[model samples]
Target: MSAQTIKGLTYPYPEPPGKGEWIEMARGVYWLQMALPMALDHINLYAIEDDDGWWVVDTGMKWGDTQERWKLLIEGPMAGKPLKGVVCTHMHPDHIGQAGWLCREYNAALYMSFGEYFTARALTQEDHAGADWRVIEHFTSAGVPFEQVQQMGRKFRGFGAIVEPMPGSYTRLTDGDSLAIGGRQWRVITGSGHSPEHVCLYSDEDKLILSGDQIIPRITSNVSVMPQEPEGNPLKRWLESLAYFIEQTHPDTLVMPAHNTPFYGIHTRLKALIDHHRGHLAAIEDACREPKSAVELFPVLFAREIGKDQLAIALGESIAHLHYLYAEGRLERQRDEQGVLRYRSVDPDHCPYAPADLTDEDVPMEV
Candidate 1:
């Protein structure tokens, strides 16, 4: 797509930051916000002063303009201290794209959850550069039509542009891991579905949580199922993660999400997100009373106007919800003569595809 078209979608094109403009949250902690081209709008990367030097929470996308902004921040606002380390919230391009570059420039170590690190490496591996074709073929094998497969190919080409390379190695982190940064102990909290091995950092001393995309104040995070990794019930895992997060974190904690302004009331926000997904699932199930493809369900799920990037996310989310319902036996699916899978809800009272009880093992966490 053309740059003009992409900009029209309200993607933030970052401009260099001026001097003395950084927002300091706590002792030796600051926030640098950058614009994103996706529906998420913008992302906030936190700068924390470590014992050695400095640590960054997440980096923005790998766009030229974003790189310039980072250059300004490093040379201007954070000029005195050397960057110590980097931490990625997840494998998403916007969060992890600049990690490798930062690590190389500062000679810093990168730390991420084991799952996130491996998943990011796999996606960015040289061998997988043109693997979108393989993904298209996989869906085709699953009975997706040739035309839809071509459309998917177009979507895959944009993936590399959004993400930058990752570091060669990373220190693997897990749930309950503690790290001292900015003079505070931050506990690692894990969540999935939004992205595999998504980590949220919570500091009890300051009641602040670096939520990444797990718990946004505005707009729900996209939970999708891609061909490379099918059988991913992102919606279910997302809900479970939200419940767990709410249970673990205090309601009054300040949530510094990657997108949108930092806010409080984690439990209330979690409830709203859960309700949003439940409503979408019900709407998809209702629409599936008559066989419908994921493409057809996209407009219904996202009635709001969307650009190509948003459309891609909407389609994936629709398919994800459809797959979840199908797995739940609430819907019956079959491939048509054209090799496209069609889905229709099964009547619980009379249809053979009656709903069945699902257990924790029945639904697995995926990104």
Candidate 2:
């Protein structure tokens, strides 16, 4: 895959490490790519060399030959170094799926932020199935057709399907925590919205950061309103994270993200991500002058019209942007005659939540 240098950010490593192969990004930090069984295929994992062993960050999705690839790396590129610990950036299946198995394999400890660890544990224990009316109603409220929503034969137990059972206990990594491995200091820089308390690691001496999903050099991360939290404004939290990262991160640091290849230009990329959402907020706010449901606002929100395939994610993210404005009183919400949630922009806004200046460029609106 070719990495695009958007908004002045440059890809230092154009060719990603293929399959079980690995590339050294720094003195002891190595980059490895693993396959995923989806359109946006592939996740990047890291192995930081320690004196006695190694520390892994962001285990790949528990699908395809991901486990086999892990075995290959452990036996091959890793030279059979035992894992010192497994550090997950967040609770996402792709990032934390193999955490349990890895920890068990090496008798290593698990480390994550409080929110990520607990949320993932909760998902593994969540019990809901067989046409839960609440779920159908939630989709309907977002203006999805009853027939289309009914097409879901059964709700898939997604987390349990992909993720190994979560570890009962974990060493919590807070925002300012520092992890010392291989004589290099990596500071934990946490951000929210993509996932609660997403942990990123920054090393000023090495001039690189394990940005995770918080700062992808290529495509933007999805910040959506999940069905569980219908009124949640993750986009607000997502927008707030830009400035947080800008202040915490150095502009020269190379970003080792979970998805795309390693890249540089943190401040520009952060502002660009901020503006991308700001553009989304602006487009929908303009269209919301006429009351529209989250689903109905897709035309102005996305570069291409969404279909049933894209409905679930598109609707969730659309609602997130709307909720951000609505919560700030820039927009007001009311249900339509069909009982679908509709939003309308309020007159001249005085919101305290002022973000960075939005670019005039038309940012692609795909979650």
Candidate 3:
């Protein structure tokens, strides 16, 4: 299979900003790229000019260098003005890692969706017995290899390490709520599956949106079945959110995504995301005709080699695809004697044959 592409998706800016520097995206909006120690190497954080100071959206990871970069920005381009507020798109560490520090530095308020704020707070607690146990059991049920599980435990960053000290309280940003920044109103649009209540900001005046991870151009957002909600059908919620965006947003609006360069053609990206998940679900359903564990379906769903460090996320995503089919009545999941869940297609006659071997070229790079 060929890699998926959204035809109209075009990158106007060919280059990204260097460390401690920013590029103007719109009249009052500037974009900054920060380094991350992961396969996904960088995150795009935005700053909008506020009447009092700059209004920042999405804080980068909590690292010493990231902190020093913020300091340099304050003394350089962001000099002489205080940050009006810090608006986080979601609870993910890369998005809200330095929120507390920024709020303290500028005496700015922290704004996030209620779901994201409390979720972050809950994950930060060291003694959350329920959360910790759920993660271990989740992997075991998915049939993750023993050594790979150990590697995952070591690689995954705990919430506290990634997210710095957070404020005791935060102001909530709800769907449809409007925030006045840079003399214009930006409305809040919330999405799920990638994270709980992910926020995307839209400005009617300029037809621009700070579409934080909701409509990325290069890669599909990771929509996994996390430990906190083992049986949750996030794929269903994700498709609904995409439908909402496709139906509501204008095609002319320029979207500034969290991961990739900003681009236009919101409808094109949204449709591609929906189709991608649907294709994955169909593949999983076909592979389940003879009953298969989540681990067994990895090859059918993913073309890449899932390393030890990536096993946890890979398993979670595989389970997510299985859950979507099970939820839709296209497949049924049952536990075996060993207590591992296995799924089989509900209609074997119509089940598509699982491909024998998928080469690197056969799998979409985004998946």
Most lDDT-accurate candidate:
2
lDDT (CA) for every model shown?
0.72, 0.80, 0.79
lDDT of 1 by residue, 85-161 (tens): 78899988888888888899878889999998988887765343234555675456444466765664555543455
lDDT (10s digit) by residue, model 2, range 94-212: 89989999988878899999999998998777755644666777788889888877775344244677888887789999989999999989999888987889999899787789888
Candidate 3: the clashing residue pairs are: none
Give model 3's TM-score versus the native structure. Answer: 0.91
How well does model 1 score by local distance difference test?
0.72
TM-score, prediction 2? 0.92
Model 2: lDDT of residue 160: 75
Alpha carbon lDDT of residue 198, candidate 2? 95
Please give the distance, in angstroms, between residue 64's alpha carbon in candidate 1 and its true position after superposition: 2.2
User: Residues 1-367, candidate 3, lDDT per residue (tens digit)?
Assistant: 2323548877888699998899999888999988887877888999899877888999998965888888878789988788888999988888888998899878989999999998888766544323365666677678765455555654344478777888888999999999999898998889888888988999877889998888888777777888778878888888999998876678889899898688888888887677677767667777677889888988886678776556666777788888888877789888877767889899855654333334333322221
Query: Cα deviation in Å at residue 273, candidate 1?
Result: 0.4
Against the true structure, what is every candidate's RMSD? Answer: 7.6, 3.2, 3.1
How many backbone clashes can be found in candidate 1?
A: 0
